[model samples]
Target: MNAQTFGPMSGEPVGPAFYLADEEHHADGGGTMLGFWIYLMSDCLIFAVLFAIYGVLGSNYAGGPSPRDLFELPLVAVNTAMLLLSSITCGFAMLAMEEGRVRRTQGWLAATALFGAAFLAIELHEFSTLIAHGATPQRSAFLSSFFTLVGTHGLHVTVGLVWMATLMAQVGRHGLIQANKRRLMCLSMFWHFLDVIWVGVFTFVYLLGMLR
Candidate 1:
């Protein structure tokens, strides 16, 4: 159960044509997938605690802006679509890789990155908008809990974008090596995992807040 070092394939003379056989490639792929699942479990633990805190403090607006006062459904909808689109584009990238189309794969990866960037931009805008309206996290217990849950999700997206860009650079420099391919697949899981978490964020933080 040792974690594997992800890079060029073994005995493949790391300079050109970095091909790895299906066996070696699949082994590493399984390892990467397992590792990512573990990471996601840890993230879930962190989110669970945040959700509990938010649950306790969610109604304590303390004479400050409430969810109905602060949330713009249309803006949050747009942000949600951005993340969903990125997840789709990331799936396309994986498909392209499976079919051995390097150029097309890069194109899909680039599109995914663009969508992710858009999501992050909207998130930053939303945060700024809230702060401008005096809805800062420090303003109330509700706000503090709100920012912690949503901000943690935003931070994950930021890291995912960075990871995508680094993988894209590797794809360009080394072409579709098996390890790189496996790593890309792992990233696809991470990207989609974030998207799923965003769904929860939208449901609990946005929808439930608005309802309550």
Candidate 2:
């Protein structure tokens, strides 16, 4: 007697079975990059709106403080240098990651975190000084937009610093595995994006505002 093989659901012969390739099971990192890029684009929109709002309300100081009166170029320049330096250090970290030098990558990440923290500190000081002088957001339309724009940027830096720290811990434990590498790359993009945005802020919001 001949016995017939049947499929799971019906009495039909099954064709050859197929399975996913090993490469198909593993991520190629492109999805991560694409998703991060989308996030950056959305963030760009947020910053663009803030920039527009600032442009419109910047002159509406309501007889309160103005950018030239509040902005200290020297301090802002130092803060900008810190963020720019962090971006460089983050690049070095990515290079180290590529080389599979886990410790070196961690060291560079630490340096980047330090620079980022310094930038935040200077920004906080500036904000405190402004608030002390009654330049609170409620004081005028200009102050409202100014704080909204710059404070939002500062908040992003803070989040980046926190993410960097978490990634450092992950690398310390996992030794630059694929997942960790992807995270680092995303963070690299984020850190550099913030640096670019700061340049715009320094120029459009500070330099031009001072001129106005």
Candidate 3:
């Protein structure tokens, strides 16, 4: 009877198994990033369409209130600051994550969530004030476009906050495991993307609208 050796001393199949596992892990990571990029692209397209619609119809106020008449630049500026600050705090969280500091990462994430919540609160207040003043979407083409664009962004921020809360719970339970780290990275991208889109909105929808 021939003796069978399954040990590494006889150059068994352990090395190939590990290599395949590593390959599969890498593939999974790459796939996740790719899928996330695709999702972001789709979101970008949605925003682009909204922007285009606004450009076409923003001036048709139907003899109603215009941008300068309605938009409170000072308040909007404060809201923008909140979002921008949240982005910075989110970056700090990512740094902590990279350093494997779970507590610090969660702290930064909590701070970011707070800032994001503040932003949403301000935006909601603005919306409510506008609606109370009879500047609703049904009033004019301009108001319709304005509400659609800004409201969509606000909805995204709300969703992001919920997502952040879920992630915080996961981090507390999992302590920055590879999956949690990947989720954080994805959220980082999403948060920064919203920041960029808001800048465009502030510039085109608010700043230029005020001038027009």
Candidate 4:
């Protein structure tokens, strides 16, 4: 944020970018959504760079296992389904919120959290299995790139689950007020964004990796 020196025009209130302490100013919620979109775009750039790195280094097995030798596509497919279904439940939660059904919204949020947790569980199991078979990140450049790309995504989902649970608790305590609605909208976007990213991961990393 640039410092605003006092001038002939310095009496005006600061923009949302420069000021966030005024909750009343942001009660309309436009600034919050725009800020969230900016954050998502930044997140997209990070993932894009990760994908490019994987494309370059994913083949450097360093005399270790290749994707076909390590990737369990069946298990990965199941994990993908869990995440994709969680997106659906997240959408349902948003709908329930719009309808002012607090209980239904919380229920769907809980479902989304469960599905997200299952996805993470499967991913961790896959990681442990690979490490058990000596396919750790240090084993090869391929494994290094693989873990970097996929693990970053898993970390995001873990954060989303935590956020979802906290938001659910807030909704339970406060109902579908304006504040909770704004949070619900933000979480909906985040959950769906992760689902889209996972589709790319499943196709580019898992499916195409198997083909390699």
RMSD (Cα, Å) of model 1: 7.7
lDDT of 3 by residue, 2-103 (tens): 333356586674445556665797756877888899999999999999999999999999999999999999999999999999999999999999999999
| Candidate 3 Cα misplacement greater than 4 A, ranges | 1-28
> Which regions in candidate 1 have their CA more than 4 angstroms from the true location?
1-27
Q: What Cα-based lDDT does every candidate model obtain?
A: 0.88, 0.92, 0.94, 0.92
> If ranked by lDDT, best first, what sequence of candidates would result?
3, 4, 2, 1
Tens-digit lDDT string for candidate 1 (109-189): 999999999999999999999999889999999999999999998999899989988998899999999888888988898
Candidate 4: list runs displaced more than 4 Å. 1-25
Model 2, global lDDT: 0.92
Superposed by TM-score, candidate 2 places the C-alpha of residue 61 at a distance from the truth, in angstroms, of 0.7
TM-score per candidate, chains pooled? 0.85, 0.89, 0.89, 0.89
1-212: candidate 4 lDDT, tens digit per residue: 55443435867645553444455567799879999999999999999999999999999999999999998899999999999999999989898999999999999999999999999999999999999988899999999999999999999999999999999899999999998999899999988999999999999999999898
Q: Give the higher-TM-score candidate: 1 or 4.
A: 4
* Prediction 3 TM-score vs. true: 0.89
Candidate 1 whole-model C-alpha lDDT, 0 to 1:
0.88
lDDT of 1 at 105: 92
